[model samples]
Target chain A: MPYEKTLEELAARRAAALAMGSPKRLAERREAGILNARERLALLFDPGSFEEAGLLAQSVRPEMAGRTPADGVVSGFGRIDGRLAGANAADFTTYGSSSAETHGKKQGFVRAACEKNGLPLVYLNECAGGRIPDIMGAAGIGRAGEGGRYTRRRSSPVLAAVLGLTYGGGAFACINADLVVMRKGSVLAVSSQMTTSVAIGEEADPQDLGGWRLHSETTGFVDAVVDTDAEAIAWIKRALSYLPDHANAATPVQADHADGDAAALLDLVPETRAKTYDIRKAIAAIADAGSVLAIKDRFAKAAVTAFARIKGRAVGIVATNPMFKGGALDPDACDKIASFIVLCDSFNLPLVFLADTPGFLVGLESERRRLPGKIMNFMAALELASVPKIALVLRKSFGQAYLNMGAGRSDTTAAWAGAEISFMDPAVAVNIVYAVKREDDPARFEDLAKEVAKGTSAYDLAAPFMAHAVIDPRETRDYLARHLDIFSRRLTGAIGDHRLADWPPAF
Target chain B: MKRTTIASEITGKVWKIEAAAGSKLAEDDPIVILESMKMEIPVSAPIDCTVVEILVAEGDTVAEGQAVAVIEG
Candidate 1:
C-alpha cells in the first residue's frame, strides 16, 4: 500500500478511458444496429484472446486532453481462429474517429506489430478523416503521413471491413488492403459529401459517391458486401481461412472434403460450343464441397476469380464466365483477375485457370477504359507469379486471351477433348480471308470455314504439345487434384518467390 | 406495383424470344436469348413480374444497355 494514491489515480484514469465517448452515442449506435470499435474487435478475435495496447493514451493537444479515449482508436494483437493476428478499429464515438497525431501512432503500432510478428492484419475502419484545426497547418500535415500509411508490401495478409461511414484515411486503408468487405449501407470515399460538394460545386449523395454498390459493381474495390457488421466480419474470417499467415509461411491445409460429382461438369458445360452456362456451377463441381469464395463477384461478370480448396489445399481459380459479355476479357475483368493473382501469389496459393474465353473484348468503350494497358498488367502479374499454374482449356481459348489465360505461361497446360484454340472463329476468319460471306456464297463459305478450322482442335494442340493433355469433361475434378499434387512445391516447401507481392491492390 | 425497364447487358442479335408480353415471369427467367461472340446470352427477368412489352423481335440487333422489355411487379 506504499503507492496507494498513485494506484487510485491509475484506476480513475483507466475508468475514464474505458468509458468511450458518452452513453447517449453508444446507445444510438446500438439502436442503429452498428457495432462499436471495441465490440468489433471482440467479434473478430477469439474469446479471451485479445491483448490491448495504448489503452491509456489520449490526445496530446492541451485543449483536447482527457477528451479522446485511446486517441480515438482501439489497437492491439490477438488470435483470430487460434492464429495470431493484429488489428486496429476506429472509435467513431470519440471525435468521429478522426485522424490525429496520436490516432496515427496507434494504427502505426498495430501495423508494425503485424509486420514484425508475421501475422495477418485486420482493419475495422469507420472514420471521419483528419481532425479539423489540429491538422490544418503544414507541420501537422507533415506528421500525418509519418507511418507509411500509403505503403503496402504484402509482407502479411491485410483485410479491411467498412462497417460505417469511412472517409479519407479509412477509405485509403480499405483500398490498400488485400481483401475488403463492406456493409451494405456504408460509404467509403476519399472525402465526405460536405467536402466533395465544396470542392466540386455539386451536391453528391454518399451512396452515389462510394457506397457498397459502387465499390462492388463499378470500382471493383470491395471483394464482398454484406447486410450487417457481423456479416462483414464473418466474410473477413472466411477469406483469411484460405490464405497463409504471411508471405514466407506455408499455406495451411485441412482434412480433405468430398468433391461434388465430377460428371456434373459434363452437363454444366455445353459441348455445343455456342451454349452458355454459369461457370460458378462448374467451379463448385471441381472444388471441394463448399470451398469456393468468389472475389469481386459483382464487379466483373465476364470473369470469375475465387479462392477454393482442392484435396484440402488452398488454390486460386480464374475462370471465364460465359454468362456475361460472351465470356470475353474486358477492362474490369482484367483488373479484377490481376489483383487476385497478386494476392494468391503473395500467399503461395497455386493457381488454376479454367479458360473458355472468346478473347479480349474489342470496342470503342473498351479502348476508352484503357483495355490494352489493363491486359498487359494482367499478363505481367500472371508471368510474375512464381506458384504453380495450370490452365485447362474447357471450350474456346482464342487470340491473346489464350496466352493470358496461362497457355505457355503456366507450368502445365491441358484441354478438354472438345476445346478449341484459334486466333478467331473459323466462320469469321473465312469471311475475312476469302471475302465470301455465308449469305453470299453458302457452299463456298462452308467449305472454306471447315478447312480453316482443321488445325484448331484439342487434338491438334496436343499433337504439337502446345496442350500437355486432352482430357474428358467428366475427368476435370480428378485431373486438377492429381496434377496440383504433382506440381506442388516439394522442393521449395510450398512457398513462392512473391514477385507480385508489391503489386498494387487496386487498378 | 413497381414498373421496371429491363435492358440488354451486352450487344448482340436477338436469337430467341422465350417470353410473351402478357406472360407472368419469375426472377431470372429467360426473356430473350442473344447471340454474340458465338455464344447464347440470356437477358433474364430481374424480378418476378408480368411482362408488359417486348421491345424487340427475334433477329433484331440490340446495343448494350438498350431497354429490351418493360415489366410490372
Candidate 2:
C-alpha cells in the first residue's frame, strides 16, 4: 500500500550486498586459516552489537562496478566488553581488499565516526596493497590523496591487527596504530616483495621483507604477536580494558578483584645485590593481581615495560630486568622504553619506574648501533612526557640511566633501604677517578669505594633531600597504590594535554 | 652439519666455559658465561648441538656481540 514494493527491492539489494566476494573465495580464505571479514568483526565485537555503516556502498566508477562490496571493507560500531568500539576490516576475499578510492573513503568515514563518537578504532588489516586500475589518472589520484591519511590527532585509541599479507594502506594502518598486534605468520610491509624488487632491483622473501619478527624486534611496530586472529582480538580487548574510552572520559575501573599478598615483595628482591632475580615477581607482588600485560617482552630483554593496575587504576611500568645485561639500557632497551613512554603519555596513563641499572651499554658494538643517540632520544622522551610519574630505585640506579629512569623527573620518588643512587658503581667510580683498577690497588680501591658508597646510600640521599623517602621493601605496594589513587585524577579531562597523543609509532 | 656461533650479549669478562669443546648439548644449553655489571650472563646455544670451539678463555674480556663459542649440529 505505502511503497511496499520499494521496501522489498531495498531488502533484496541489501541481502545481495552482504553476500561478499564469492563462496569459493571465502572458502579459500577459511582454508588458509584466515577469518572472513564479517567473522573477524563478529569476533571483535560483543554478540549482536555491531551496527554496520556503508554496508551497501559499492564502487563509485562504472568500470569497477559489482566488484567492490562494501567498498572492500566492512566498517561498523560495536561493543567490546560492553564498551563502544569501531572497526574497519579489509575483506580480503574482495579484489584482494586492495585500497581504491571507495575503500579509502570508507576507511576515512569509519575513522571520522570513531573520532566523533569517541570510540576506540580497531583495523583488521589484510590486503594486497592498492588497487591498480581503480586508482589511475587525475580524479582517482585526488580521491586517493583525500582518503586514508593518518594525522594521529584522535583522542581515542587506535589499534590494528595484521592478520594476513598486509601491504601499502594496510601497512600504514597497522604501523600508525597506537598499538599493533600481529599474527605470527603474517607480514606487514610498505610494498609487496615483487613490487619492491622491481622498484629497487633487489629481491628478498616476503617474510624477510616485513615479517612479524622484524616488526616486533627491529621496528618495534608490533606490540604483541599471536598465533591466531582470535588470540589477537582477545589481546585487543584486554588492552582496551586498561585505557579510558576517550580523552575526556575517566579511565575505566573494573573489578579485576586483585587477590595477592603485597608483603610478598619483601622477599622478591634478592638480599645480595649481585644475584639476579626475576623483576616480574616483584612487579606481580606490588601490582593488582592478574592485571599485568607485558609488551615486547622477548625483544628488549633488559628493559621490561608492561601495563598493570594498582587498586583498579591503570599505570605504565618501566622496570629493569636484572636477568638481562645486568639491567643495562642498550639500543633496543632505549627504543622499547621510549615507545612505551609515548604510548602511556598518549593515553593519559601514569608511569611507574622501577630502576636498577648499572649504566647504559658501552662498547664497540654499542657505539656501532648508535647507543648514545638512542639514549639521548630516550632521555628526550622521558623529559618531554608530562604524565604523572612515580619512581622507585629498587636496588642499583647508577649513571645517566638513573636520571633517564625518572629518578629526578617523577612527581613522587622513593628508594628502598638497600638501594644505591650514584653517578656510577662505587668500584667503577674509584677506578676512573684514581686511575687504578682493583687488581692494581685493591686496598686503596676498597677504601675509595667505601668512601664513595657512604655518600650514595639510600639513607644519605633521603637525608639530603635527593629522595623523597627510603621505605621498606614491603611498603612498595602500599606506597604505589596510594600514590596512584591520588594521581588517578590526572587521567581525566584536559589536566594532561596528551602531548604525545598524536605521536607517530614508526620511531 | 650446521655451525652456530654463540655470542656474548654484553661487554664483560668470560667468567667460565660451561661446556667444554666437543661436549654435546640440547637447545638453550649454556655454553659460556660472561660477567659484567657484577652479573653472570650465560651465552646459550639456540639449538641442540655439540661444542665445536671455545673462543675466549676465562678472565678474557669480550665485547658485546663478540663470538664466545661455536657449536655444530
Candidate 3:
C-alpha cells in the first residue's frame, strides 16, 4: 500500500483514525516502541473489520467535564478470524482509568458487548489501581461498580494484559480472566508491592511482591508470563486458538486420532519399578504434539495438571508421577488438582487422569498444611465436575489417592485401571500395620509386611470393585480414546456457568 | 561489579550440580541439587554469570534460604 495522497488528505485520514485523545498518546507509545490502544485493537482484530461503539464517550464530572476521552476506556465490537470479539481499553494515563462515569460507560459496554454478542472480551489494562480521592468517601463509594469487577458471565474467554502495574481493579481483571499474561518487571497484585510491604512491614521487590515468581512459580495464578507486551499479545492468540468465540460453537478442530489405533498407548509407561520416567513424556506420546500446556508445574511436582490435545481435541490431563516424591499428593498438590479439575470442567474440556499415586503425603508438613481440607476440596471438585472424565491408574493406585483420582462408584466416576492398581506399597503397608523389621527380626517383619502389602496390588482392589477394570498398561491410549469418545457434554455447555472464574486464583 | 548467589529455597542436602565451575551460564541454570524431605530441589543461578567457584558439593546439607555459591550477577 503506497501513500501518494496530499498532506491535507493524509492529515484528515490520520485525524479521523486517532479518535479522541489517542493521537498524542499514540505518538508517545510509538516513541516507546509500545502499541497504542487503537494499535492493539488492530493487532487483535481482523484487519478492515473493526466497528467501534462509543468512540466519543467521555467523563461526566463537572471538575473533569468536556473531557471526551471516552472515559479513558474504549469499547468496540470486531470480528477476529470471523469470530466476534469485544475489545476494551482502560486509559492508564487518563485519570488513572478511574471510575468516575468516564470509563464506567465503556467498561459496562464492553461487558454487555461480550454477553450480547457471544464474543471473547479483550482488556489491555495498565492502570494505577482505581481512582483514589475521587473513588473514595460517600460520593466516590456511590460509583463503586466502576471501582470493581462486573463479570460477563464467563460466556466467552476474557484475555487481559498487565503491561504495567496491574493492581486493584486492573489486577482483578487479569485474575478473573481465563488467561492472563504479565510482562517482565510488571506486576499483577491486589495492591502495589509498596502497599503490601508497608502493611506487612517488609521491603518489597515487585518480583517478590506481585512478582512473576509469586504468580507463576509460587501461587500458580497467572497462566503465562512473557518478557514483553508483544509476546503477551502472541500468547493471547495461542490461548484463543484452543477456545471458540463462545460455548455455543462446536470445537473448531476434531481429534487427530482419526480412525483409532494411534499406536498402542499402553507401552508409554515403563514396567520397571525403580526407573523413573516423566509422565509428560507419556502425555506427549499419546496426545498430539505441542498441544499440552502444563499448568502449575513447580507447585505440584507430583501431579501434572496440564491442558492437552488428544486427537487434536482439547482435554485436561491430570496425572501423578511417582518419580516426583513417589507421586504422593501433598496439600499443595491437592489444591492444584482440585482447581485444575474445576477449571477444565468449566471450560468444557474432557479430563484424563493418569493415576500413579501412593496416596496423600503423610507426616508433619502434610498434617500442618491441612491435607484433609485439600483432599475434601478435591473430592468436591470431582463430584461437581460434569465434563467427560476418564481416569487410568498407570501404576500404584494405593489407598485414598485412587479415590481422589476419581475411582470407585460411577456416580460421576469412570475409573479404569492399567495393570498397576494397588491398595498400598507392601513396604509402606507393612511399616504402618505389621511394621517392617530393621535387621535381626527383619525377615519376620518383612514377611508380615509383605502379607499386608499384598492388599496394595491391583487385583486385591479390583476384587472389591474399587477399580472398574484392570486393563494392561500398554492398552491405555486406546482405552482412553474409547472412553472419551462416549462421555457426554450435553449438560455442561447447556448451562454455561464457570463459578470458579471468580474463585480465588490460588489456594 | 558485585556477585550474588541464589540458594536452595528449602532446607535440604545438596544432591547434585547441573552446572560446572567456570562455565558460562544463563539466568536460571541450576548449580546444585538440594535433597529435602526426600525430594530433590534445584539450586538455580542468581543471574547471568560465570560459575566462578563451587563452594558446596553433593551430599552437603544446606538450610533453606542459604546461599550455596556466589556468582557475578
Best by TM-score: 1
TM-score of each: 0.97, 0.94, 0.80
* Between candidates 1 and 3, the lDDT winner: 1
Give one digit per residue, the lDDT tens place, for model 3 in B33-73: 66543344456676788876777888787764577887775
Ordering by DockQ: 1, 2, 3
Q: Model 3, chain B: what is the TM-score?
A: 0.82
Candidate 1 regions with alpha-carbon error over 4 angstroms: none
Individual DockQ of the candidates? 0.74, 0.57, 0.16
The deviation in Å at residue B38 for candidate 3 is 7.9
Model 1 earns a TM-score of: 0.97
Model 1 residue A268 CA deviation (Å) reads 1.1
- The chain B TM-scores of all candidates, as shown, are 0.96, 0.93, 0.82
Residue A125 of model 1, lDDT score: 93
Q: Provide the clashing-pair count of each candidate structure.
A: 0, 0, 13
Which residue pairs come into collision in candidate 2?
none
Error of 1 at A408 (Å): 1.8
Off by over 4 Å in 2: A1-4, A490-495, B1-3, B22-29, B45-53, B71-73
How much native contact recovery, as a fraction, does model 1 achieve?
A: 0.70
Compose the digit string of candidate 2's lDDT tens values, residues A1-507: 799999999898788778889889999878978788999999999999999998888887787677677878998889998988889998988888998877887888889888888889999999898787777778766667774366677478888999999998899888778778999989999998999889999898888899989988777778899999899999998988888777756666666567555688767788777666779878888888888998887777899999998878788999999878888888989989998998887777889999978878777778888999999888888888877889899888888899999997888789999998888888777878878788888898788878878778898778878788898888888888887776556534424667666655666
